[model samples]
Target: MKVIVEGLHSRGHQVSVVRSSDSWYIKETSPFYTSITLDIESGFGENFITTFVAQLLETQREGKSAWTRFKLEMEQAQKASELHENTCKMLEMLFENKEVIQSLHKAKYDLVLTDPAIPGGVILGHYLRLPLVFNVRWTSQGEGHLSIAPSPLSYVPMTGTELSDKMSFLQRLLNVIIFGFTEYQISQYVLPNYVCLIEKYLGPDTDYLSLFQAADLWLMRVDFVFEFPRPTMPNVVYMGGFQCKPAKPLPQHLEEFVQSSGEHGVIIMSLGTLIGELPHDLADEIAAAFAKLPQKVIWRYKGDRPATLGNNTLLVDWMPQSDLLGHPKIKLFVAHGGTNGVQEAIYHGVPILGLPLIFDQRDNLFRIEVRGAGKIIDIFTMNEDTFFQGIQEVLNEPSYKKNMQRLSRLHRDQPMKPLDTALFWIEFVMRHKGAAHLRTESYRLPWYSYHSVDVMLLLVGVVLIILGTFAALIRCLCSIVHADGTFRRKG
Candidate 1:
C-alpha cells in the first residue's frame, strides 16, 4: 500500500490513508498522504500476532501427528474468528460515527484501494458505492483467485496443501478435501460477523462475498512466472514483483561484511517479521549449521544468542533485505518465503534455501523448488547436518543460480514495469468510473447457477425422459404384434 501511495503521490494524486490508531506502521503524519486514525483496535495488533505465532510454532514443533495438525487448524480458525470479530467491532464503530461517515462522504474519493485480506475496506467501499480496486493476493477467505476465477481442484492446489499444478489422483483428492475444509473455515469462522454488519447496515440482500468479488479491478500480486497456469477473470491484472526494484547501495557495515566473505560469498536469512525467534534448540541447530559454512551468514533474528553462534555469523534484528539480496557478493537467500522476499529474490536472481515456518510459506518455496531455483527445509525435522547440506546444495550447484537467473530474465522482460501496469489499471478504473465491463457478474449468481449445475440437471432430465418414452413405445408395438399373431392362430 505504501508503494502504491508513493506512486500515486508522485503522479500528483492526493491520497488519504485510513488506519487504526494502534497501527504499528502507519503514522499520523506523512507528506505522501493524509492519515485518518480510527480509535479502534485492529485485531491483528503486534502483541496478538506475536503471541499467536509463538503458539503456532510451538504446536508445530509438537510433531506432525494428526492431533497436532488438528490443533493447529482449530487454533488458526479460532484466531481468524477473533481477528474478524475485532474488525467487525471497528466497522460497527465507524458506521455509528456520523462525523466520520459524513467526512468520508464529502471526500468523494475516486476509488477505494484496499488489500482485501481483511474486508473492512471492501465493505466500506461498497457502502460508499465507489469503484473498488484490490491490491491483493489473499482475501479474507484464502487466495484471491479462488473467489472470482474458475479454479478446478484437479490442478489449482489449495493454500496449505503445498502441491503444484501437476498432481496425482490422490493429490487431487487431498486438494478437494482441503478445499472443502477451507470453505468450511471461511463460512463458519470468518463470515458470520461480517454477515451481521451487512444485514444491519447494507441490507439483507448485500452479500459479503459478492462485495469482495464485485471489485472493479483486482491488481493481483502474482504473475504466470511465479504462479501456475489457471483460469482467471478479465478484471484480474497480474502485477507480481511490482514492489521489487533495482537495489540501492547497502549500509557500510553490511557492505564491509559482504566484502569480508571474499571468494566464498554471503548468505542471508530472515523469517520475516512475525516469527522473530525460534525454539531455542532449533535456533542453536541453525546457528551450528551456519558455523560450519565457509560462506559468511547474516541472520535476522530477535532471539537469544544461540550457544553455537559462530564468528562467521552476524545476527541482527533487521537488515536491508532487498539490498542484500541484490548484492553481487550474495550467494544464497535463506528466507521464510514471504511474497515480498520471494519476488525480491526472483528480481535479484538469488536462489533460496527456504525455511518455511507457517501459512503459505511452504507453498511459495515449493513453487521455487519446482522451478529448480530453491530448496525447502522442514523446520520441524531439520537438524544441523540436513540444514548445512541444503545450503551447500544451493550454493555448490550451478543449476540453482542458473535457474533463478532465468526466472529473473522472465520477470524483468515485461512490456511495462509491474507497478506501472498496476497504476494503469487503477487509473483505468477511475477514468471509467469503474471497470464494470471487465468484471464478471458471476459473483451475483447462485452457487448452482455459477457452476451450471442447474443446466446440467435439466439436460440430464431431458435425456432420461426421451429414453423412457422410447422404451414405452417399443413395448406397446411388441404387444400389438403379439395380439395379431394370437388372433391369426385362433382363426
Candidate 2:
C-alpha cells in the first residue's frame, strides 16, 4: 500500500492515509500523504501479533496430527475473530463520530483504496459512496481471487491445502474440504461482527462480502509467474514484484563480507518480520546447518545467539532484504516464503531454500517447489542434517537457478512496470469515477445462480417435460392402433 501511495504521490496526486492511533508502522506524519489518525486501536498491535505467531510456532512444533491441526485452526480463527471484533469496535466509533464522517464526505475523495483483509475501509468506502480499489491479495474471507474470480476446486488449491494446480481425486477432495473449512471459518469467526456493524450502519441489504466483490479495481499482489494459471477477472491487475528494484551498492561492511566469500557466493536467511526468533533448539539447528556451508551466511535474527554459532555466519537484527537478494554474490535465499520475499527472489532470479513458518508461507513455497525453483523443509521435522542437505540441493543444482531466472525474465517482459500499471488503473478509476464496466456482476447473483445450478435445474426440467410429453403421445397412439385392429377383426 505504501508503494501505491508513493506512486500516486509521485504522480501529483494528493493522498490522505487513514490509520489507527495505536498503529505501530503507520506514522502520524508523512510527506507523501496526510494522515487521518483515528483515536482507536488498530486491532493488530506488535506484541499481540508477536505473541500469536509464537504460539503458532509452538503448536506447529507439537506435531502434525489431525488434532494438532484442528487446534491450530481453531486458535487462528479465534484470534482472527478477536482482531475483527476490535476492528468493528473501531469502526463503530468512527461511524458514530459525526465530525469524522462529515469530514470524510466533504473531502470528496474519488475512491477508497484499501487492503480488504480487514473490511473496515471497505465499509467506510461504501458509506462515503466512493469508488473502491483494493490493494489486496487476502480479503476478510480468503484470497481475493476466491471471492471475485471463478475458482474451480478441481485445480485451484485453497490456502492451507498447499496443493498445486494439478490434483488427483483425493487432492481435489481435500481442496473442496479445505474450502468448506475456510467458508466455515469466515462464517463462524470472520463475519459475525462485521455483519452486525453492517446491518446497523450500512443497512441490512448491504452484504459485507459484496462490498469486497464490488471494488472497482483490484491491484492484485500476484504475478502468474509465481502464481498458478487460474481464472481471473479483467478488473484485477497483477503487480506482484512492484516493490522490487535494482540493487544499490551494499554497505561497506556487508560488501566486504560478500567479497570475502570469494567464489563460494553468499546465502542469506531471514524468517520475515513476524518470527524474529525461533525456539532455541530450532535456532541451534539452523545455525548448525549454516556452519556446514562454505558460502558466507547473512542471517536476520532477533533471538539469542545460537550455541552452534559459527564464524561463517553474520547475524543482524535487520537486513536490507531486497538489496541483499538483488546482489550478484547472493546464491540462495533462506526464506519464510512471505509474498514479498518470494516475489523479490523471483525478481532477482535467486533460488530459494524455503523455511516456511505460518499462514501462506507453506503454500507460497509449495508453488516455488512445484516450479522447480525451490525446496521446502518442514520446520517442525527439520534438523541440522536435513536443513544443510536442503540448502546444498538448491545451491548445488543448476535447475533451481535456471528456473528462477526464467521467472525473472517473464516477470520483466511486461510492457509497463507493474507499479506503473497499478498506478494507471488507479488513476483510470479516478478518471472514470469507477470501473463498473470492467467489473463482473457475479457478486450480485445468489450462490445457486452464480454456479448456474438454477439454470441446470431449469434445463433438466425442460428436458423432462419434453420427454414426458413424447412418452404419453407414443402410449396413446399404440393404444388407439390396438383398438382399431380389434374393431377391424370383429367386423
lDDT (0-100) at residue 296 of candidate 2?
A: 98
Cα displacement (Å) at residue 33, model 1? 0.9
Kindly report which residue pairs in candidate 1 clash with one another: none
Model 1 C-alpha RMSD vs. true structure (Å) is 1.3
lDDT of each: 0.92, 0.92
lDDT string for model 2 (1-491, tens) is 88889889999999999999888888889999999999888679898899999899989889989998899999999999999999999999999999998999999998999999888889899888899999999998989898899999998989998898989999999999999999999999987888778999989898888888899999999989989999999999999899889888889999999999999999999999888898899999999989988999999999999999999999999899999999999999999999999999999999999988888899999999999999999989999999999998899999999999999999999899999999999999999999999999988999999889999999999999999999999999999999999999999
Against the true structure, candidate 2 reaches a TM-score of 0.98
Q: Cα deviation of 272 in candidate 1 (Å)?
A: 0.8
Backbone clashes for every candidate come to 0, 0
- lDDT computed for candidate 1: 0.92
Compared with the true structure, what per-residue lDDT tens digits does model 1 show for residues 228-258? Answer: 8999989999999999988899999989999
